[model samples]
Target: MNALRAACLALALVFCCTPPAWGEGFALNEWSARGVALANGLVGRADDVSTLAYNAAGITRLPGTHVMGGLAFIAPSGSVETRRADGTRSTAAKPNTWTAPHAYISHQLNDTVWLGMGVFSRFGLGNSYSGNWPGRYNMYDVGVQTISFVPTLALKLNEMFSVSAGLDIMHGHMYLGTKIPTVAAGTFRRFDNDMQLEGDGWGVGAHLGLHMRLNEQWSVGLSYKSQVTMHLTGDVKFDWHGDNLARRQAHLPEARDCDAEATLQLPDSLALGVAFKPLDNLSFEAGATWTRWSTYNALNIYMKDYDAISNKEWRDGWNFNASVEYRPLDWWALRAGFFYETPVVNEDYADFIVPTNGRKTLSLGMGFTWNNWALDLAYAHVWVNSTDYGSTGASGIRNIGITGGRSKNVSADICMFSLSYAF
Candidate 1:
């Protein structure tokens, strides 16, 4: 069918013209206000319903039914610079705001068993640039979103330890837009043919957790999330401006919407934490997470008559964090934390989609408890290290090569709040 051929043409254009980095460098760790306030250091001290996300085994610490829900507001800013023989040009990303929401419920089944469920976003990204930006052919506007649902069961083993396991069902969606240059055909001098692709997919994975109460002064927790591979099927739409005669003469396919599919392999991660409590009112925790991002070495998109591939060659990454919490009164608690993350993208394969090296974050927050109701609030500032790109022979869509360039002034701010009730 003509539609099928059109689809194949669109998919072939996708990899031939741009780097397929739609879902990279957008993992989320801000599952709850308390978790963010503690810089995700709560794996060992996971005492609330949010434990379903950090360490489900920690739910053994709760006696009755509990529920918690919240949202995180995020704002990110940055710019990209391209260097050429003529001069240097810079383009700022358009302003954007994103929100991630989380919810969890846990119940104790008898004295040794606990059941819990949670829904939250684990990966996402949203960035946009002007249509005329130098890198428009690589990427002008893009958005990726993912949500995960987990149901877990925990068993308390004596008084010293607990273990838990869960099934992870994840759903992901992506949208991307780029400009196709008609100059390549030699018949049309325009550079405004727009191409847009949108798709959504689902994947299944698993997670495990272990919690230990060593004596009374120190506690330990460990968790692991398995990898998931998603098969995304979507439609690609092309908006062409040149007349049919000129397009035919240029060997350009007719503007049409067609079906396409791609496969993405999401990474797995391991986290460990240790908490110390010198007194009943104070606690300190340290944690680290390792992500196996090497699984994302390549991407492939397929259509009926065409297929394309992009190589990423990304490396593994890590996140280290420390946090402290103090309860001056039985009903009031204050928290502070810090974290540092290592880069995963190899500069040799870096592209405009993710133009940063690593990240550093600092956060502060407070919690209030009254009767059976609890409220938590947190704020965090993230600093992204500037990174150089294009120098390593990176190429844009249509084989437009970038010999040298860099990204600068990258940063983000986050605000989160959560409310919980026990019955």
Candidate 2:
């Protein structure tokens, strides 16, 4: 295959497990938001320039000198409650707040190629439970974050067709903070693990796009991004900080080789988008996206040659999205959309840390322009169904194990704001 084709294949594999079951990238960008009203309507069909996250070729569609930036706030409206076998009920620890930021610059290089650069996050989740949280025994607290950056290039093959590609530079860290209990002669000891898993790694990934202009009022766009693999190497230290201890104990998992080493699986995806303009002032868009979540079967935590635990228990399903845009006048536009997503964690491999499920959502947004500047506003509400599950292990007195799953109406809201400059 050619160099561009090779790059596409490699990058697609890296994104295999990119989306977070808990809460990752903001809902607007990863789920529906594309370029401007004209771009988001077609479902990102004009991948030439909807920020660096979509098709690099989309840069070709932007004005010769243009820049865009935005921020998003996500809030989850529900809580996870667990009941142990002993009839002891407690609420899952959760700090529901997700903050996301994004920026991109697109410029035309002559008439054949366009260049752009962008910075953003792919997946991230931060949940904290006080040391005295209810289900402190099994899961007390956790904080995880990940991000990525990219420089892209778009080439116009001719007036009818164009192609674009990009290289991604990614970095992030993962750490679990919690306390486990220790049992001694007729007494219970509470100690801290203080085991922090962190590392800075880098890898190469790519994206491809094809834009076609059919007649004067119709156009179509398609794009693909390869997955990436990262090797996270860091430090592991454990100590006991408890008073009146009969003896010291440690239940540490070895770090394969060197003090620590780990590999994370992202995932790949394909998007097909289309745009239409029946009138000079009106536009509409509809598109589809598919991700390879089946590849995330497990996560194996190990040390040198010893075995820890496999993440294969996590299962990710498919997702769908649609949107539209309208320009009533020279500087005003209106937009709206719908979303549906399948489950990520399978019935056999579900956890409280990563609570996910089948979900449906409704969203609305609008944009206003003033000479060299433009502003976009959007909001979305999601409804999720409870998940099916089996017991993982014994909780309290063996009789307090996790059981009896119930349907939950978990909900979420998103607020998006963006500023753009045309040069």
Best by TM-score: 1
Q: What TM-score would each prediction reach against the true structure?
A: 0.92, 0.82
**Model 2: what TM-score?**
0.82
Q: Which ten residues in a row have the lowest lDDT in candidate 2?
A: 7-16
Q: Superposing all C-alpha atoms, what RMSD in Å does each candidate have to the true structure?
A: 3.3, 7.9
lDDT of 1 by residue, 115-178 (tens): 9998988787777899988888667888777889999999999798999999999998888787
Winning candidate number (lDDT): 1
Instruction: Give candidate 1 misplaced runs (Cα > 4 Å).
Output: 1-24, 184-187, 241-254, 392-398
Q: lDDT tens string, model 2, 1-423?
A: 132122221112111222342331211243223342232344344532344575566667676787777876767645555554556344544547776677778888798878888776666655555565543443444444556678888888887887878887777665544333433323444343433334456666777777787756787778787776766655443334333332332222211112445566666767677777788776666776676666666544334544433344444445566666677888887877775666655555444444456677677787788998877777777676665435443222122355645324456676767777888
Q: List the residue pairs that clash in candidate 1.
A: 17-397, 17-398
Candidate 1 is scored at a TM of 0.92
